[model samples]
Target: MKVALIDYGSGNLRSAAKAIQRAADENALTLDLKVTARVEDVVAADAIVLPGVGAFADCYRGLSSLDGMIAALNDQVITKAKPFLGICVGMQLMASVGREHGEHPGLGWIDGAVELLTPSDPALKIPHMGWNQLNLLQPQHPVLAGIAPGAHAYFVHSYHMVPRDRAVVLAEADYGGPVLAAIGRDNMVGTQFHPEKSQATGLRLLANFLRWRP
Candidate 1:
């Protein structure tokens, strides 16, 4: 199978590429993975991975900057019904809109908004960095097959997605309160944390993503 790891000048693509490659190797699957920005490449891929870093508006602009990229993504992912995984800001971009940088539009694949993570506790950090435990809300999700509850994942963001439909939330983590960790519906799945940096837990999720049919 072919997987397109989108490169929109958002952040480092090496770690995500290496992790997914490792997952494919461990699974003994002959996978062709590429870090690409081309719409044609995205259209031809079996699975699509949209990885992002930095601000939501910036990432959205970068992804949409390429002519026909967003439309192609919609055609391939939404129309074709291909499996898709969005990481971090990429996941945030799936929301209908984002509050970061003065309310920017998003892919709207998922019915939600990306808003700043507001920890009720006065002492909690803004970025919500470091390791945090995941509480699985959708245990039967294919992308979360081997992932266990309370699994620690690396997170480094100040904003989190708040989906309009609660059923789309796959998992959540506690910051000052419940924070979104993962969301999914049909063939679409997203993670607020970086699976590439989460070591064992991350790798397990990556492996599951590689093997996931939907």
Candidate 2:
């Protein structure tokens, strides 16, 4: 299978690619992984993985700067129903709008908005870092197969996505309060946590994603 690891200059390209490659190797799955910025590569790929870090507006800007990338992504991932995985800010980009710097439009694949993490407790940090236990909302989801409800995943972010439709949320973590950990609909799934940095749990999820037919 051909997997396009999108490189729009905002994500941890090498680490994400390495983790995905490791997953494929461990599963004995033959995957043609391509770390690319080209729209043609994305169009030709069997699946797509979008990994991103930093601010929402900045990441969106970087991705939009790439000629025809947005359109191609829409066609391949949405129109054609290609399997897609978005990590961290890449997941936030799936929301309708982002309120990090200013109100910036997103891909709007999922009905939601990205907003700052305002934990109910005052002592909690803005950027929710480190490993947190995932509370699986949809444990039966294919990408989450073999991943237990309390499995720990690494996270580093100051904002969280609030999906208007609660059914899209697949998992959540508590950082003084409930914070979105995962979201999905149809062939698309996203994680606020960095699966590439989540060690064994991360690898398991990635391996599941690699074999996921949807």
Candidate 3:
């Protein structure tokens, strides 16, 4: 299968690439994959991965500047229902608006908003990093299947997702609160955690997504 990792000049590109390679190797399957900023690659790709690591507003601005990138992405992902994956800031961009930048509009592909996870408990650290357990809300999804409930995944962001549709959440993790850890809407799926950094569990999730026929 061919997969395209979006290179929006976003951070974590190489790590995401290595992770995909690792996942494929673990499954003994070869994936035709490359990192390109080209819109045609995204349009023609069997699966599109939007790997991001940066501020939501800045990422949005950069992507918007790229000629026809957002339009092509919308055509392939939002309209055509091609399998799509977003990581970290990429996931944040899928929200309707993000408070991080004074209420900037997102792709609005999913009904949600991005906000800081405020904790009633004191001493709750922002950017909940390291390995944390995820409660798989939608276990039947190919992207989440075989991954046992309460598996640990890597995360490093101050903001958390609040999807308008609870059904869109595939998994949730506790950092200081129960935040939407992952989302799957129609042919689109996104992860706040770095599957690349989560080791075996993360690889399983990525591989499961790749093998998914729908």
Candidate 4:
């Protein structure tokens, strides 16, 4: 199976690639995982993973600058129904708009807005860095298979996707309140945290993602 780990001039591509490789090896599944910026590569991929770091507007611009990328993604993921995963700022891009560094348009795949985290307690912090436990909302979801409730995942972001529909939230984490840790619907799935950097929990999620049918 071919999995396209999209390189849109951002994200820690090497780490994600390595984690995917490790997951494939552990699962004994032979996968053609290619990290590419080429639109053609994404068009032919069985699954697509979009990982991003930095501001939402910048990442969106980086993706939009790539000729035919947005169109290819729409065709392959929205129309063709190939599985899609977005990580961190990548996940934020699925929202209708991101309110970071001025208002920025997003892919609008999910009905939500990316807003800055406003933890109730002032001492909770902004970025919400380090490991946090996932409060599983959709325990039966395929992308979350083998990932038990309360699994700690590494997170490094200030903005979070405030999904319009609560059902879309696959898991949540509490800082000062419930933070959207993951969301999924149909063939699309996303995580606010870096599953690649979450150690065993991350590895399990990656493995599940590879084996996921939808």
Best by lDDT: 2
Worst 10 residues of 1 by lDDT: 205-214
Candidate 2 colliding pairs, count: 0
Please state the error at residue 111 of candidate 4 in Å.
Answer: 0.7
Q: Per-prediction RMSD in angstroms? A: 0.8, 0.6, 1.0, 0.7
Global CA lDDT computed for model 2: 0.95
lDDT of each: 0.92, 0.95, 0.87, 0.93
Model 4 worst lDDT run, 10 consecutive residues: 205-214
Model 4 Cα displacement at 52 (Å)?
0.6
How well is each residue in 34-111 modelled by candidate 3, as lDDT tens digits?
Answer: 798898888778988998888889889888888999999999887888889999999889999988858899999988
Error of 3 at 75 (Å): 0.5
lDDT of 2 at 44: 94
Worst 10 residues of 2 by lDDT: 118-127
**Can you list the residue pairs that collide in candidate 1?**
none
lDDT of 2 by residue, 6-120 (tens): 9999999999999999999999999999999999999999999999999999999999999999999999999999999999999999999999978999999998899999999
